[model samples]
Target: MPPVPQQHGHGMESPSIFQKSEMGAMMGGGVGLTIGFIFGSWSIIRHGAGPRGFMATLSQYMLSSAATFSFFLAIGSVIRSDSPLALRMEAMQLQLSASNPILRSKAESAQIVRARWAEERSRASN
Candidate 1:
């Protein structure tokens, strides 16, 4: 096979929930900061307040607004992403989870529970 050009790198783009959500949060925070600044400024202009204490309060409000927007946008983006839940998990989760001792133990416990449930069902039937 002929070596593909450097620009035409492998086209397999794995969609990851964490990456998508982080991107969404950053975008949302930027928007929220702009909005909060405008609103906060307008509010101060209307109310007519002190420069020192009032400005401090206004800055706090802007930061809070940015945080709130970031949080909700992150969750909303995750929910609205095109990928199915299973695929989303596959992309974001560490590949080592399968070999991780904690995960393996949890999986084993689930199997034991399934076996017990199957036995119960069989006994009830008989």
Candidate 2:
């Protein structure tokens, strides 16, 4: 029996909470910015900017909306909750365990290469 590549024991790890939070914040900020721009433009057309000036008022709206959304979203996964890295590792395991000799060999070799590269990178970083 061949040895199975265990995803859990392997050096591969799911995205950290911080990474997830950052992703959510980025997504929310972008969406909020777009929405803010649209609403600000409409507001300017309908009511006109006060003495604060059009650019100033528009920017205030954009920044406020972006900050509000990013803060809330960063607290939790507002858009993406799953780690893509986990998904990739799962897919790789399927290939590595495939009954087809060629596919298994390729997957095994790829896994070995990646592990070696990661080791080297860690060494270099230190």
Candidate 3:
């Protein structure tokens, strides 16, 4: 009988909570800045804010929206990092072991290799 391979650590480690939160904040801020810029520019253009007023209002909207976005994004990141979704998925994968398409494909390939090995052994014996 062939020795079974030992299983190692889980496939890939998820990012740390801090890293996730930071990434979320950056992405949210970028999105918010884009949205704020578009709306702010449109408003300033439509309402004919003078140069100074336009600048002030635009800056205020941009900063406030970005800050709000970052806060929500950080909160979402924290929730995701601490969620049980990943654990549930892993458990489901384990439970469905042989039924998993990826695992099934690998198993089929291994069977082909084993059959070839057996054929080689038989030929050598004969």
Candidate 4:
């Protein structure tokens, strides 16, 4: 009878630190803009006790709305690729794992190589 191979321990490789920072910044900016919009609009709506104040408030509201829309539009344009950040992260992790010495054993290395080849073939096919 053949002896069973010992199982190796390998944690998944992590995402690129840069991509994570970018994603965090993107999300943070989005949330900050949302909060700003809400508070700015509230302040405009609640304190317009005279015609001049109301006109000024209305003008500010329109400008704010336009600016917010443009900012998000720019972000949408920048991230227009269908490949999401999570997918990019997964590919990076796979690449790092495939290259790392600690994760590369004879058996595991062979398996990783075959898997990578298969992935490439499929990608080429598509």
- As a TM-score, model 4 comes out at 0.30
TM-score of 1: 0.54
Q: Report how far off residue 66 is in candidate 3 (Å).
A: 0.8
Per-model lDDT: 0.77, 0.80, 0.79, 0.60
**Cα RMSD (angstroms) for every candidate in the order listed:** 13.2, 10.9, 11.0, 14.8
Candidate 4 per-residue C-alpha lDDT over 19-124 given as tens digits, one digit per residue, 9 for 90 to 100: 5445555665566557655765677767653566655665565556556655665466446433346687976787678565254569988999999999989999
Clashing pairs in 2: none
lDDT of 3 by residue, 8-119 (tens): 3575545667877998999889988888888888888888766678779898778888888988998898887743467889867886788654445778889989999999
Candidate 4 CA-lDDT value: 0.60
Q: Number of backbone collisions per candidate, in order?
A: 0, 0, 0, 0
TM-score of each: 0.54, 0.52, 0.53, 0.30
Error of 4 at 83 (Å): 23
Judging by TM-score, tell me the better candidate of 1 and 2. 1
Lowest lDDT 10-mer window, candidate 1? 5-14
